[model samples]
Target chain A: MDDVTETDLQAYVDGQLPEARRADVEAYLAARPEETSRLAAYRTQRDALRELHADVLAEPPPARLVHAAEGIRGAMRARLARWGLAAGWIVLGLAVGATAGWQLHAWNSPVARAAPGIARQAAVAHATYTPEVRHPVEVGADQEAHLVAWLSKRLGGSVRAPRLAGFPLVGGRLLPGESGPVAQFMYQNESGRRLTLYVRNEPGSGAETAFRYAREGKIGVFYWIDRSFGYALSGELEREELYAVASQVYRQLNP
Target chain B: MHAAEFVALIPRLRRYARALVGDRASADDLVQDTLERAWARFHLWQRGTDLRAWLFTVMHNVNANRARALRVHSEFDEDAPEAQFRPAENGLLELRDLERALADLPVEQREVLLLVALEDMSYTEAAATLGIPIGTVMSRLSRGRERLRVLMHGPQAAVRLKRVK
Candidate 1:
């Protein structure tokens, strides 16, 4: 056996040495009386130290320790509750922000959301036909009741040919709109200046709107939206003239 | 870890605590502090490691912090090892001398020596628990074992031996 170092001998007492080293330590201890006595003394120290306080392990743990352990679980549960509440608030905040975004976008974008296509068609149709010499009216004022009835049936809402104090009904025609067909009714006065009112339903999902005006070159247009349908008046005239005509359209449609 | 696991660790903690502080009540206080700390920092403990060693390390640290904060190193205080001297029910003189010698060890040596000699922890485990190097554990163990031997049987121990013999 190699000379057993103190560490190896201690390892034997600690039961930490591998078997080969431990056997060597055992043989080494068997031969040396002085080292053997030292080993025995160390063993006694270990035993008395253990015997001195070994009973402590069998004693029941104090109540404070038990309560402290329970406190850990309770604190974790409270933290989880706090985290759950925080997550709930985050979700609610996202929902509110989304709804607010929708409401703001709804309230602020009427000019952008207005049925520009319908109004443009009105302007284009007026521009297309105001210069024509004939065929300006497809079904003339003689078929006015039939015109209103057929147009209303197609548009899914009332199509009123608005009254202008100077301009009487010239004629009415059906034009294609974004969702379905549109109705354009023409009126003319002594100087032959004409105005067209375009009406359609099923344009877009929107709430009520107010009278807003736009101009396509010299042609003035006044447009507004209600719960279900949209109306636009197009004519080469003063803004006041078209406003008056659109107000008349609005009042009659609502009435 | 479950409550049962923590419960299982309690006795060992108390034993180590009593070994370090050498008093039952103070040792229980140390165990309570260790448990409270372990509960708070349980997540920081990695699984698949020695939980007992981890708990011992926590108790060692808690005891150290309390000692430093209170500046109270009740090194062999009167009530502790002296209490073991009341002529044992069988008057085991040798055992009484051994207990007194153990309590007389320096705090650092007792911490390392008891962890190894009594708790039967490996040197590496004792080193890790006391946040010292393994070589340091060995040196402290050697010094502590030698001090305990001299105190138990040196010329100064003649009186104890005569009483026992």
Candidate 2:
């Protein structure tokens, strides 16, 4: 009786001890009132728990969760089809490679060429517009609200003109492009350097693509598409400087 | 298992899952996830091994993962009051209190306890289902039961001990 450990009492409560040992523990509990109380407490807790959760067995599970799981099973067959005879890891590797290849091809395109595209576009826009004192923009920054509404309407989805934090708004204009109507919002720093954000409805069938960087002439353009709407930030600034401005644009636009 | 076969096990899976998670909604999610995983990996289940044990193991692993995610996101902090602890609904010796108390236990202890008390799994079987040692299973169940006993009666020890005259 004095030799019994707390674990032994717990084992007895759990019904894990052999019958003889269990009987011995029971007898020991009978003689020790405190131990008996603990057993009673354990039994009550077990019974209470059973009462609480027993109905969960009868309750209907949510259809949505079950459906999602079913959907996964359905997709498994199709996934295996595209995987060919490759092992899971090999297939995963191939998938990663394919994604990288597609990304490289897309990123290197004119809309997303390395270093030249955006820079060239930015330089073109800056050079063409900055010298114009009377016609810097088709629409001035004074009509900011109307500019956003008009641009958003033309873009076929809601578009917010990005507010560049480190720079002040110069003016915005509507320009004809190979893509649909493009809205260009220009911002200037205290140093008189200009940045242009070009947004339009993606050309042709429209592509849902991620961020791509390109250099157009002396300008650098960082472009991305969300749904059918396309966004491009073009500037003659250095890569990091251009990116810093673009980051501000992205935050404001996304927010 | 095929789609039909997987669907058929849904009820039994839910029962075992409710017993494991101690929450109806989460248990249902766990069972659904389990069946999906099972269907995808059915071929990997060695033909000679116990299907019930294998299913239980998969469900156990999935629940463990969900528990880890819950810890990380802690998204349901608003429901934390009800998540790990909720009082029994009415006056009875039903399983609700047990379920709530079960939720309060750590993942390992709760799994062993449920496998033993509700699933009627032997220590060896529970161990195999958990991929743990039999001794570990014994220790967990022992500790879990002791903790459950304390939580169950700590508040109502006096009323529970009173006999009807």
Top-DockQ structure, candidate number: 1
Compute the TM-score of each model's chain A versus the native chain A and list the values: 0.53, 0.50
Provide the interface RMSD of candidate 2 in angstroms, 1 decimal place. Answer: 14.0
Clash number by candidate, in order: 0, 30
Expressed as tens digits, the lDDT of each residue in B47-152 for candidate 1 is 5788888888888888788878998765643123222222223323376576666677778888888889777898888988888988778867866776677766
* Regions of candidate 2 where Cα sits further than 4 Å from its true position: A1-16, A59-255, B1-8, B69-99, B155-165
TM-score of 2: 0.46
Predicted candidate 1 versus true structure: per-residue lDDT over A139-212, tens digit per residue: 89988899888888878876777677788998788888767788888888899888888777845635444355
Interface-residue RMSD per candidate? 20.3, 14.0
Residues A1-255, candidate 2: write the lDDT tens digits: 555655566456556666657666777877978658667666665555445555655666567545533444334443454333234444455577766555544433533232233335545666688667677777778888898888778766777777787777777887776546767888878887777787767545243333445676677776655446667787777866775676676667655
Instruction: Name the TM-score of candidate 1.
Output: 0.49
DockQ (0 to 1) for model 1: 0.17
Clashing pairs in 1: none
Q: Candidate 2 docking category? A: incorrect
